[model samples]
Target: MSFILGFAGSNSSTSINYKLVRYTATLIKDPQVRLMDMAHCPFPMYSEDYEKENGFSNSLIEFKNDLQISKGIIISVNEHNGNPSAYFKNLIDWLSRLDRNFIKDKKVLLMATSGGKRGAIGSLEVAEKMLSRFGADITGTFSLPNFFDNFDIDKGILDDELAVEHANALKEFLAKITV
Candidate 1:
């Protein structure tokens, strides 16, 4: 595997989901990892009219190119009223327009985290289903709830049990990343 791509659905600079994605990327030892914050990769909201008028933007092309070269991906999504956030949904819309199968055959470790107890599971579930349609081979999932209480800025996951679960999921994700 050349590199693993990691990103969160939320573009917020302070997003807990992005923190979780970064923590997960830290656990991987060998491969070159690119940890991207969605804030820096913004593109216009997708629309047929806009696409017809302007085609793919340079940012969208670069984002798709990153996906093309990645051997695996670690993604954590944010939730909004028990569904994926509109910002992330827009990102999906744009990426799909470029190529529905842009993520084809890529190994994926799906994850979610939030301040709430459900840990953004709603968005996680939705993304799991949606990513498969985009041709991601999802290998494992981990949800860390109550982010404030369960995670530390320097320490990563605080709960020992959840740490084990996260590690196991990451291990599985890494084992099959080259398949």
Candidate 2:
């Protein structure tokens, strides 16, 4: 079975982005979904000096390996000051160093969620533009706004309009990867 790697950009234990990604993964019927927690793949702050002083961390290597094996990816990013969360950026930096094309042309379904009405659009846009250069075949995108009111930990998306939008995006994503 083809595996799809899913992860949230935030490391928060109760991150809404995490919940969104998990819910998004459930929409894909065929692929075997593997949810990853950034907290588990810890790495020191990435810097050229740090890399020279200490070799690549094992966790970083394993993360890259996961990307290598997966047929597709689902990433739900968290925004901080109109940018991707620091932890997620750090992870990407390290992985980029290992291989600039770490995504390796795999289809990606990019998503984001936030408490504000903008739904972390800034970070999602940045990822869509940037990740493509690094070999991500971005198949689709989705955003969830006012996450607390629209989504439940147990029930998933509560808003019908938002749910339809999300479902359409997932359908497009599945078509791209499965074809």
Candidate 3:
């Protein structure tokens, strides 16, 4: 089976985006999913001086390696103040320094979730625009709005209408990549 790497942009222990990604990962049948928790992959804040002095963190190197081996990527971004969360941006900054094309040639399913009605749309857009330039082959994009009302912590999506929408999006994503 093809190996797919999945992660959330947020590092929060109880991130809605993380739950969304994990639930989506379970729907794919052909690919074997390996979920990554950003909280575990700690790296120092990105800075020119820091890079020059300490070099790339081991966490960054390991993350890069994971991307290199994976056939596809699934990321659900979390928005903070209508933008990508600082934790996610920091990882991106460090990864960019290592290789601008770190996500090169991988089919990506870009997603996001939020408690608000917008569903972290801003952060998803930002990730889509930036990662595409770095060689991410975006297969599909999805967002779950009003996460608490539509999703259950253990049972996945709770609302039928929203669940169908998400399932269709995920189906399209898997189809495009697996082909």
Candidate 4:
């Protein structure tokens, strides 16, 4: 069976993106899901000096291992100030230090959720650009705009129509990539 690494790119204790990522992972029918928290594996900010001085954090190395072993990834970003959250960028930077092409040949499901109208569009585009350059095989993308109003825990996706659309899109993409 394929295994998917699912993560949200925020460290907030009550992150809506985390909720959305988890929800998206659960929608996968065949693959086993392993949910990871960036908060649990925080790494120091990336710098060449830091890399030469301290080496990669053990946690960051382990996170890299997880990515290396996974068949696919489901990642949701939480944007701050129209960019990646500090926690997310730190992880990305640390991972890149191990290999400039950390995501080389990896399949990724890019997703984002936000409280505003754009749904973390800035961070989503930024991640797409960076990860693609690193050789990520982007399978699909999703965005939940105005997250608080669009999604409800009790009701699942508040917009059932949109939820079906997103779920179908994800399923199709995952199918294409897994083969």
Among the numbered candidates, top lDDT falls to 1
lDDT of 1 at 150: 99
C-alpha RMSD values across all candidates: 1.1, 1.1, 1.2, 1.5
Query: Quick one: best TM-score, which candidate?
Result: 1
lDDT of 1 at 167: 95
Per-residue lDDT for 21 in model 1? 90
The models' CA-based lDDT, in order, is: 0.90, 0.89, 0.88, 0.83
Query: Which regions of candidate 1 are displaced past 4 Å?
Result: none
Minimum summed lDDT over a 10-residue window in model 2 is located at 37-46
**What clash pairs does model 1 have?**
none
On lDDT, the stronger of 1 and 4 is 1
Which runs of model 3 end up more than 4 angstroms from their true locations? none
lDDT of 1 at 8: 94
lDDT of 1 by residue, 1-179 (tens): 48999999998888889999988877788797899899887777788999999999898888888988988899999999999889889988898989888888889999998899999999999999999998899999999999999999899999999999999999999999755
- Report the candidate with higher TM-score, 1 versus 4: 1
How high is the lDDT of residue 163 in model 1?
A: 96
Clashes of each: 0, 0, 0, 0
Give a tens-digit lDDT track for model 2, residues 142-165: 999999889998889999999999
